[model samples]
Target: MRGTLVATGVVVVIALGYVLSCIIRPFRDCWVCDGKAHHRSKRNPKLSRPCRWCRSTGKRLRIGRRAWNRVRRVQRDA
Candidate 1:
C-alpha cells in the first residue's frame, strides 16, 4: 500500500510541474513588464527607466528563443 501511495504521489508531482511550466510559457518576459518595464531609480534620486530584460515584468527569461524551442520540442513529442 505504501508503495502504491508513493507512486501516485510521484505522478501527481510530475503532472503539477508540467502544468506549471505550461501556465507561464506564452509571455516573452515578466508578465507585468513584458521584459521592458522599469521603476524609479535610487542612485539618481530622480531617474526612471524600463528594464532592459524584463522592464516592469518581474519574470526574466534567460533564453527566450531556447524556451520557445523547448515548447516546440514538447509539442512535437506530445
Candidate 2:
C-alpha cells in the first residue's frame, strides 16, 4: 500500500511538472514588472499600462493540442 501511494504521488508530481513546463510565459507583460516595473519613473507615477507580450493576462503561452501532436509525430518519425 505504501508503494502504491508513492507511485501515485510520483505520477501526480510528473503530471504537475509537465503542466508547468508547458507554461511559456510565467507572467504578464514584461514579466520583469508585472506590468508596472517599467513605469516606475518619477515623471509618470500613474501609468496603468498592460504588458504587450501577455496583454495583461498573467498566464504563459500554452502549446495548442494540434501543434503539439504534430511535433510529436515529427519526433517519432525521426
Candidate 3:
C-alpha cells in the first residue's frame, strides 16, 4: 500500500509537469516577426519599424499562454 501510494503521487506530479510544459512551451518567441520584431518596410524597402504584431518586444505571448503561466505559478506554489 505504501509503495502504491508513492507511485501514484509520482505519476500525478509527472503528469502535472507535462501539462505545464505543453501549456507553456508554445509562446517562447514571436512567430509573426520571426523574433526580430521588425522588418524592412514594404513601401520604402530601406526603413524598418517595430512589428505591429509583437509591438516590437520580440517576445509575444498569447492570452491563453499568459493564463497558463499564471496557472502554472499557482500550481507550483501549491
Candidate 4:
C-alpha cells in the first residue's frame, strides 16, 4: 500500500508539471525543422524549404494545449 501510494504521488507530480508546462509554454519547436522554420534539401545543402508541419513558424502547439483547446471548444458548443 505504501509503495503504491508513493508511485501514485510521483505520477501525479509528473502530470501536474506537464500541465503547468503546457499552460506556461503552449508551443514547442517543430520536430521536423527543430525551430529553424526550414529544412535543407537532400541533394543540395544550399537550397532549403519552409517546414510544412509548422507552416514555417518554427513552432507547434503542444499536445496538452491542443487537447485543452478541444475540450474548451466542446464545452462552449455544448
Candidate 5:
C-alpha cells in the first residue's frame, strides 16, 4: 500500500512537470515590463528603471531551454 502511494505520487509529479514544460514557453517577453524598455519600481526609492537581465530589450530566454536548443543545434550541425 505504501509502495503504491509512492509510485502514484511520482507519476503525478511527472505529469505536472510535463504539463508545465509544455505550457510555459521556452522564451517569452518579460512580463514585468511588458516588453517595455523599463520596469516600474515597486519601492519608494524610484518610480522606474531599465531592466538588467533583458538589457531593457524586454526579451527573456529560459536558461535551460536555451542551452537545450544550443545542444540540439550543435548535434544537428555535426
Candidate 6:
C-alpha cells in the first residue's frame, strides 16, 4: 500500500508538470523539420520545400493543448 501510494504520487507530479508545461508553452517545434520550417531535397541539398506537418510555421500545438482546446470547444458548444 505504501509503495502504491508513492507510485501514484510520482505519476500525479509528472502529469501536473506536463499540464503546466502545456499551458506555459503550448507550441513545440515541428518534429519533421525540427522547427526549420523547410525540408531539404534528398537529391539536392540546396533545394528545400516548406514543411507539410507544420505548414511552414515551424511549430505545432502540443497534444495536451490541442486536447484542452477541444474540450473547451465542446463545453462552449454544449
Query: Number of the top candidate by lDDT?
Result: 6
Cα lDDT of model 4 by residue, 5-73, tens digit:
999999999999999999999999999899999998999999999999999999999999999999999
Candidate 1 collision pairs: 33-57, 35-54, 35-55, 36-54, 36-55, 37-55, 37-56, 51-55
**Whole-model lDDT per candidate:** 0.66, 0.58, 0.79, 0.96, 0.76, 0.96
RMSD of each: 6.2, 6.9, 8.4, 1.3, 4.7, 1.3
After superposition, which runs of candidate 1 have C-alpha atoms over 4 Å from their true positions? 1-4, 7-11, 17-36, 55-78
How does model 3 fare in lDDT? 0.79
Assess candidate 2 and give its lDDT.
0.58
**Among all windows of ten consecutive residues in candidate 2, which has the lowest summed lDDT?**
24-33
Tens digit of per-residue lDDT, candidate 5, span 31-63 = 667788697866754688898778898977665
- TM-score order, best first, reads 6, 4, 3, 5, 1, 2
Model 2 scores a TM of 0.33
Candidate 2 per-residue lDDT, tens place, 1-78, comes to: 999999999999987876665564333334545544343445777755554555555443344433576798999999
Could you tell me every candidate's TM-score relative to the true structure? 0.38, 0.33, 0.44, 0.88, 0.42, 0.88
Better of 2 and 3 by TM-score: 3
Model 3, span 23-59: residue lDDT tens: 7564556887888889778899789988888898777
Candidate 1 RMSD to the correct structure: 6.2
Clashing pairs in 3: none
Model 1: per-residue Cα lDDT over 1-78, one tens digit each? 999999999999987765566566634456544444775578895788766556456665535445767889999999
Cα error, residue 45 of model 2, in Å, equals 58
How does candidate 1 score on lDDT?
Answer: 0.66
